[model samples]
Target: MPLTGYTIPRSPTGRSSLVPYPPWHYVGDFLVVEYWADPDKAVTVLPNGLDPHPDAGRCALVFADWQSCSDAGGELLDPSRSQYKECFVVVNALLDGEEVTTCPFIWVDRDFALTRGWLQGFPKKLGSIWVTRTFGLDSPADPGVRAGARFGATCAAYERRVAEATVTLERISETGPTHNDPPIVNVRHFARLEAGRHDEPAVHELARSRSRDRIVSPVWEGVATLSLYGAEHEEHDLLAPVRVGKGFRFTFGYTVDDQEIVKDIRS
Candidate 1:
């Protein structure tokens, strides 16, 4: 018997697998808040190869509602596999004199999204994420994208609230956040299960995002507030904000075709 080309739970139709092979297409609406944290605490969370950024401790908490589909486009018809909510922590870091972003923590509402993230070196966990939805209708709750409009988002894991953010739209921004333009770097690490290989990982490397066909909407900037909660088994407090910066809301789309390895240290 033969199996599928990629992913597990292979079958004749490959329907049992969680994620399919790229190119994966995603479009998402996002609410992001920028902040600065304690540089000392940040150093402990970043990976070894990454150095602290010059303007150290700069970070962003992003809340997104997304719809994704593969090249086949079959998943688009199945909402269960195509739609998800996500929240993540992005930290600025430097790798060989080049500025890049790294995600130290992330949470999603679906399993497929988690697996897809792991493949790209994102440490994604299961959590409940919610982002305020806006509409074009003329109603009190359905606020339009304009000055004075407010947006709220929250993330919770293990039945504990992890973080929350509120952004009040002040004006339309001509340019989006520049800090996020840097290529995202991630540590792709997979531990081995063999008895003798317990001390080593089967795959350990640094990879950069290779997404293409990017499209972004007009960004909205505003005043914002953020709060991070500490929990028994979680370290969300490590990146607590020292100074909260501006907030932004936008929509963007990109395609995940592949990844480029920047470092390989498999042993």
Candidate 2:
């Protein structure tokens, strides 16, 4: 007899996993803004093994409208299963003596995205996200072809807004890659408390993951205006912007190749 297909079990139970595979595709619009925060306050929120970068209190706020598909080829056109929006506040941190970026806070609107992010160790929550842009329909020969865009997000819980940001971009200029920026890294931690567990949590684990490129194209440079509000969650307080940096937009895709489990914090 010949095999047709394999039946794999879902994780947290069986050996099969949705990650560590290919054909994950993502198309989205991103509005990324860099800012400065208090180093002391920033350090307090990072996970056990990560530290804030010393070269100023640098951070990035990202607003994205995402259409993502995984494990299924030619399925990108279907929005019913693979459409979501995200807002993330990431800070520059040092991991194992190397400078990297770590997301301390993030919010998304879709359940599938929420589960995927949680399984990958991202502290993701539910929120509303939106992005609007103005495009000029000028002739191809016209100097100004593409106009600017705006990005906004509201982190809400129980129908109440916890955090929000409104960002506007006036113009965009394409730019080359700069080597000064650090690589993006993430710290994942998960735990569960069982009924019989008394001394500590029943399960505690920590891991690290990063994006493996499909491609990064069309880096743009521009000016932006940002207003951030963090009233509902104290964690949002660390994202207060002291100085705003240039705005940039780019498109990139990658596969979730693998992650390394660095520590097991179950005591």
Candidate 3:
């Protein structure tokens, strides 16, 4: 068989011709809150070849309002073109004796974001995400500079609710790191068919750099309350928060540039 040479447009006209590119840029406000869970429960959800760090009972919940674009300049032209929201849950774990984080569940509101995330190996599902901020009014004598923020997210699969949570914060202050945690690691799973003959599923353990190509303009910490709901999907039970930890909010932007795949999971 002979092949024809043709130019593939950067912005393909059809869905079937879409190509995934790197340096994906996103500008967003996010809330990152950690919670304490049963240590035994945390270990159970991890995929094969990953283990929870001994004494690793921490779960982090993130709510993000994203204005994402394929390139840096596209964001300023029309920020609303690819605006979306996402919420995800990750737990501290160990991979090959190194501390890492594992995301067992996540939800996003946009289809393009969902598809892009899946290509990156995130366990992302479609759902609704809402975040709100309220400022407190101060009297003339006293200058009040505090505000409250609320985050809510719900995920459904096959017409059933899989997981949902509400997090509220009354006060936030710009502060330093309250705790030192390891970089995030994800179980990336995708399938590839080569030459329409060879089919194989890839499951890799990927780690993201903690400080590269990421901008945290201002990081704020606050006290928060978390309320988790029951789930129709049993896998989500691993995320049920038993105790609350520190709450944080930040304005962040990042370019997806450096990621190391530690190992591949074959089983």
TM-score on alpha carbons, each prediction:
0.96, 0.76, 0.75
The number of residue pairs in model 3 that clash at the backbone is 0
The lDDT per prediction is 0.89, 0.63, 0.64
Q: Which of 1 and 2 is the better model by TM-score?
A: 1
Model 3, 1-267: lDDT tens per residue? 332211123333332323235556777876677787788888887887778787678887777888876654554576455688887778887778877777778888877677767656678888777664323455444323244444454555555665555544455554533322466667677665667634556545554443246777555566666655555653666667889777766667877745666667654
Instruction: State the lDDT of candidate 2 residue by residue for 1-267, as single tens digits.
Output: 432222223554432543324445676766677777777777777766676677547887777777776666434565666778888887788877888777778888887677677666778888777655434456443223134544455556546565555544454445522212576555554444566655565444556665565676566656655555655553676668778777766655666646677666564
What does candidate 1's lDDT look like per residue over 1-267, in tens digits? 666745777887777777898899999999999998898887778876789899888888999999999998998888998999999988899999899998888999999999999999999999999999987887998877989999999999999999999999999987767655688998888888999878799888889989899998899999999999998878968999999999999999999988999988663
Best by lDDT: 1
Better of 2 and 3 by TM-score: 2
* Whole-structure CA lDDT of model 2: 0.63
